[model samples]
Target chain A: MTLTTLPPPHHEPVAPHDLRARVTDVLLRFIDDQDQILRDVDPELSTMTTALREFVLSSGKRLRSTFCYWGWRGAGGAPDDEGILVAASALELLQGCALIHDDVMDSSDTRRGLPTMHRRFARWHRLGDLHGSPEEFGTSVAILLGDLCLSWCAQMFDGCGLSEAAISRAKPAFHQMHTELMAGQYLDLLGPARGGGSSERARLIIDYKTARYTVGRPLELGALLADGGPELRARYAAYARPLGEAFQLRDDVLGVFGDTERTGKPAGDDLRAGKHTVMMDLTRSRATAAQRAVLDALFGNPDLDRDGIGKIQDIIRETGALASVNALIEEHRTAALSHLTDSLLETETQATLTELAITVTNRDY
Target chain B: MTLTTLPPPHHEPVAPHDLRARVTDVLLRFIDDQDQILRDVDPELSTMTTALREFVLSSGKRLRSTFCYWGWRGAGGAPDDEGILVAASALELLQGCALIHDDVMDSSDTRRGLPTMHRRFARWHRLGDLHGSPEEFGTSVAILLGDLCLSWCAQMFDGCGLSEAAISRAKPAFHQMHTELMAGQYLDLLGPARGGGSSERARLIIDYKTARYTVGRPLELGALLADGGPELRARYAAYARPLGEAFQLRDDVLGVFGDTERTGKPAGDDLRAGKHTVMMDLTRSRATAAQRAVLDALFGNPDLDRDGIGKIQDIIRETGALASVNALIEEHRTAALSHLTDSLLETETQATLTELAITVTNRDY
Candidate 1:
């Protein structure tokens, strides 16, 4: 079943880079506007806008923006409409909110190759000799900052230059996306403890947390803005879901196998953390009795060292877990791409989306 | 300057209580709707909805909604428009977002006299024997829940059954409230660390964090929905800001002097937290060098004992800080009530607003 549903990432980088650059500019302008509004309240409050600007503009793949843009393009949104670009940029704020909270949830110290917001705030507490536990203070500041991002996401979306009709069309999808994303985050927290680890359960999480959020809804948002009807939305979902899971699976694979320098964290970090990923469940289902014992001993061990990591890596490879995951990736990729066949989307936008699928699934860094 | 601008809460509870009950019912229905939506996504995610319902419905004064409902009434809003009630209920969700984030920021273990959301989530981790740090897990869950509330606040406001014109009128105020509240939170955080602790700085924090957020904008939102003109909005703000600050000042007083059973926390909780407010700044300014030395040693001490709290309390009283704060509250009350004198508000709604001012400032719990 995995064989037919997934496919490998296309190897080379896809270059539809201008739109991404444009989306960044849109975000910067919005932040600058906010800077003025906040400054009027008090000069000190502008620090938040500055932090928000740094968080948003410093780095991002702008994948959702591109997906949203292309979705609009596919639905005959005017390529020259700056309004769509402004509207599409709102997705980044939404993503930023998610990442800020996700890092806090995971107790992650870094993101985008920089200290995560909470870590930075924690450091401030120590350096400033502030009155509170640095960790608690840091967590608090990050939580507030994340909240600011969530609030600003809605502000940006509502204030972005979309026509009333376009906004009306997009509103339900946007609202549903947020509700789903939070629900998905809750479900993810439930996963490791609930301990199903079955591929079916994994797929369900992926659908809510990644696939629909990262791709399907965004694409539908674009289509909705341009008045794309039911059939078009259905097609977008068909193409989005498998590809999104493929993207996540690739991240999981790279977490174990990719070079530490490239992935920005240690190889097998996920193994030490024992992240409730489906790939591992598949491995557990197939592992020999001795391998199962090794897995049980090493997985999620905080003190698991390089040697333990290497051993687990070897078991994963030896057990054909790597091969099967690759098989699953290919199956999803094929399933996603198959929807593009005979699609009514504008040819250029369709091609860009196809390329995005490759870049999303295959990126090593 | 502070003494001339603030006022005391009237001692009796004014009971123009229909709007509050109506608002609660509206919140319950909204939460129920969200419950259904999340359950549709997955059974487990519905737990978030349950938690949210508990948080919102448990114990809030419904101050913002009351202010809003009366603002609408004052602006000739039909006392019967259920839509306005729904729109006003959105404030409680917005308040929910603020309280959850604020509790996390303060690292306070309780809210409305119960374990904070993070505390509750953390307890779940310990009880369920989940695999990570319970505190971290709890904080993360709380942060996500806050984001969910913030999102639903907007969604509810937008989806509330208002005509397009009313929504358009209300949107900017609603949007501004969120932006300013976050900015105020940021300013409040900066106060202790940056340490001017002057009355001016504290007042600025109050204006943004509590004054406008707690009262001003909610009224404006109601007025806007009812097409209250600029004159009416200006009058509303003039009435709101001083009354809002009086409410905050009264809270500061209660935090120090009210019964723990009534206040829902220990006496001097704000002093223990070293919360920067105009009332405290006055104490600092008037304190003798010996008293200053005592304060420097004890304020914000996380391990502050009951003896230390008593010492601080004695100083606050002796320095005449408590007297000046009450004096300021009365001044502001007079200023706020002065607006009602010539106001064109419906007599019934005017009486309600006047009574609300007394209840909000005077509440023991």
Candidate 2:
């Protein structure tokens, strides 16, 4: 079945509000504690660390951590405060580190309604009259700071005090998450360099880079930590796969059409960067000669200005790319919901997860 | 006792020849196996992966892995075929990954008598006629490839089937090693940016970054995994700490005065790059006004010619920096050997490790 056709499960609606709120609260506290540890390490380093923590902890869905928490809960594990929170926090820290490094790699200049970490570091370099060129100093700081976060993430996991058996069982999944993410990143880097590959190849890259790392593996990791058996692991995959796809599909749409004010990025930034998104692949495959000319002229041009971005957006819309992407998002969201029906979770837990799936796909920014 | 005055141990010599040969064989075989897995995943991606594996596995002292193996053996652990080798190999892989990324970050052009990974990728980009600027493409490829190596390192460790008890015991040391390495890296980066901190601060960075991560932690990790108690762990530190300092001191000397033909890197590259070494701290502190002027003119100029590098080297030597650094290296090496006397290890194992320490510090390259 496609993602757009699943029926909603029957359950009282009160459970999700409480669970999501609890998860959000725990996440905030986790970030604060980690920030304190970072500060204690080196006061001078704290400014960048605090900024990075704030950027990541700023308002967002926190969906991955929630999924991990619920996955643990669904596997019949008790909510031991330290274990669950540490596990979830570790995931968040990993994500934070990834996003900061990804931004610098992508040359993104803004995030979450503020200057991106690299850009801020550049500003600080100028103000402080640091020894190196401002840009080099900025990039260096970002790299080191990201490395710090990555190291801290591992430390948190090691110190989490989880049962040895549980940690060992979950360890492979964690390693896979990192390896797969890097593989996905490599594919993404290679995609544009190689020009165009098969539609299937492009889709595979998207699935690996975003879908699998963002949702599938996280859910699996949580379940594994909770000692969930293979059946439960299999059951979670059904929900995770479609949810992941829908999530990426929505991101692609936002890349093309979302407002900068709401998204906290330049409009059509992805187009300017020549990201090899699924939407771009579909448009390239199906566009007319005139549309192709538009792409050829503007795609990957470093000098593409505001007017150029506008024209590219117009072409995307006129070619019906936006509608098709929206349709895919809906399709995957429905498919993800359908998977929940077959899952052997508590009714209340299943309902909360289902609602989460809907909110995730429908997110505006 | 101070690190410079310890007495050497009197022990029967144990042949490390067998252990070294066996460990090297296992490491190469495992690397080849991992390469096969990469090829299976996607033959197209194997080009970069193959080059990376070959480049890293080519030739090195394998000092870290050797320490790990010896630590395990010294702790009375039996030499298992796959277990110790796998764990040691994982550490080696991690070291390789760090080196690859660190080389790029430092903008070095060569390693081990070959083009650095970034330069290699740049050449590939030119040959392949990839889309963007070849330099940018090369940088992107190296970055992603380094990330892949890091991920693979973690994966190798995850697959290592150490008993939960052993891993749990060893895990803290593992995490601290990473943390200290990164912290040391941060200090190194900051040293140049801040135009050289106090001499003591510079020494601390070298100790933490090079000495601890390279030697001390590797030995401790292996010992911990073998279920060594606190007394045993303390004994490794007694040997490892001074040896690590000597190792860094030797590296500092090599950075300034090593032969380019043997080192692969250009002689005095560190001086030309204005690396904030402890030697630099000493030189700057002791230089006459004319010498200080010369240093200020050439330091970090990025346009320093061969003559300029030679002049800087002369200044360092004339200022007594070279002699001081040499004396420090000898002092630390002597201290390290002295500590071997205190280790509660088998006579043969103590002799082997002591010999290994001498080999590490006295290497010409």
Candidate 3:
């Protein structure tokens, strides 16, 4: 079914106080309950479970969970705690698994102002006087623990109490999201390794990895599980797609320029790690020979010290690449807003989603 | 559901021959098909995928798939190629995911006379003059690749055309096996690191990690999917449990003494790597102070030369640990055979399973 086109917005302000608070409360409590269930699986596993739960449930905007909740709500389903919470919790578990594994893959020592799970396990190994190499021991534990979390995510999703038809319909979309995300990740990894790829390739990776899976699928999954017909699904995707891209573009900007305290990461981590992001592509495409040489030397170099990072950041700004990327972010944000206006949605739901989209693009964290 | 008991095995071996041939043929073909799918995911990814698939699939006995097929046939279902092949393929996929990830975790450089996936990826990174640390790039690629394999396994299982009820019933057992296997792996990792866990702990890890999940669960899942009633289920478990233990016990013995060509590994690789196996535990528990001193110097030391491994091996044999572990393997095998006789299974099914169990314990590979 096709989504109905929405008329231009009337000059009415849509306040978001109630929906925001309700979504936050549901998400936080649901995550806590899931953490409890994870721990309950084996009390002796408390150390690993507790650490993972804390990392996942730590303060964040919970944007994906919010999208899911509103998507379900927008589909004409009453926001029952069980369904919303379970869906939200499952998403959070998946996020946890991804983040933990991602940190290991990236070799990032700290996350959320704490040692990453692998590093923490490594410390434990050192303290325990483990017989083997501490680093190897740490990695082994972390890998197994992440697999546990991934397994738990599937199990929890399966047990979400949604009807069989709802689950069956949503399953393909869920699998697609997973496959796309991994493919996107593969592109990201291959980009820098190959030393060069087109701007189109970089943009596609960003869209699939961050835009669609992070926002589009979660929103669609919620609507699907709520038994929304095809029209609502189409409408939600219309709103979610560009908004998700804008959100990731903003994140790409932050990864290079945001404050360490706010981002919970070392400043210019993306640049130093040589991540082949959209912003990087914008800079590279427009760079002079001397600037390109500098970029090659600094970006993706594990040996890049703080001064090297600072110089690279300065070069990025000087090349006008940062400004252009910022402009692109705004372009996507405006386009997303236009799509939202052109979709069929209830007045209240529209307002809530619009506010969320704005927050996503503007948020510092 | 409790499994039924099997009837006494007659001296006939004819029933097992056809089942083994069919199961092996289907399993190898499935592995080839999956490798093709992996290559199709991205042609660029073929180099690594082909190497991994070949290393894992070549000349290997499809033991787990065999158990699954036998379990299905023993459930009193008419022997059918389609159902058996699908279930066996699913098991093979699961095994592939486990091995790929496990090799990375163990930091092994080779598998089946070929470079491990991670190691191969590392070699590619170096050869291509990739921009990042070769080791890190290798690991990142391997991690993402393994995750892809895992997700594909789930998707393939979901598409296996099993009835919803059957799929649902089999899922818990599938999940449970994965969880137990990971937990057991953790215990094994932790045991070696800690170096002071009780012998019982080591044995428990073996039973759960290698014995139950590797053999018991695969067999049970096959039976359940084939519509095995409680009686048949319990009977299969009774036959599988001890037989599975014997399989692992034999592996422990082989780890220390088996030929490199036959085992597809270097002789005393486990000793050199300082694996905390049941035999190791038994040796430690019985060692005198002088013997303990020798082990302490050699065990888990990265500096261990060829002579050190040989010395450790000699000590293990001298302490009678080898003989005792071998004796335990025989005992478990005998118990499995006795249980098979005591079970109330169909005569034909019993004969097939009995021969399979014996082959597992006696096989050199």
Best by TM-score: 1
**Model 3 regions lying over 4 Å from their true place:** A1-44, A59-61, A288-297, A301-311, B1-56, B81-84, B288-290, B303-310
lDDT of 1 by residue, A1-365 (tens): 22223445544445356777788888888889889988887887776777777887766577777788888888888988988787788888889889888888888887757888889888978898876577877777777788877877777777777777788779889999998898888888877765555677677888988898889988999898888888888999999999989988988888877767667766666887888777788788889999999999998887899899888888887888878888888789888988887858778877877777767776662
Per DockQ, what order, best first? 1, 2, 3
Model 3 per-residue lDDT tens digits across residues B1-365: 00012233344443345555665565456546655754555556455456545544563666677777777777765677576556666666556657767888888887777787788888988998877678887887777776665665566566667777777777778777767777677777777677777767767776777667767887788888887888777766776778777888777777766666767777666876777777888898889999999998887777777788788888888888877877787788887778667546777777767777766665553
Top candidate by DockQ: 1
Encode model 2's per-residue lDDT on A1-365: one tens digit a residue: 21223344334332245555655565556556655754565555556556655665574656666777778878877865568657766776667667777777777787877777778888887897778777766766676666656656666665666777787788878876776676677677777777776767767766777667877877787899889999888888887887788888877777666667757778767877787777787788778999899899997777788899878877777777767887888898888888788548877568767877776676552
Residue A339 Cα positional deviation in candidate 3, in Å, after optimal superposition: 2.9
Q: Please give the ranking of all candidate structures by TM-score, highest first, separated by commas.
A: 1, 2, 3
Report the C-alpha displacement of residue B326, candidate 1, in angstroms: 0.7
Q: Pick the candidate with the highest lDDT.
A: 1
What TM-score does model 2 achieve against the real structure?
0.90
- Candidate 3, residue B172: lDDT: 75
For residues A15-133, write the lDDT of model 3, one tens digit per residue: 24454455445544544564464355444455665566566556465666667767777777675656655665566655666677788887789886789888988888889786777
Interface RMSD of 3: 2.1
Chain A TM-score of prediction number 1: 0.94
Model 2: pairs clashing at backbone N, Cα or C within 3 Å: A3-A331, A3-A334, A3-A335, B7-B338
Instruction: Report lDDT (Cα) of residue B230, candidate 1.
Output: 94
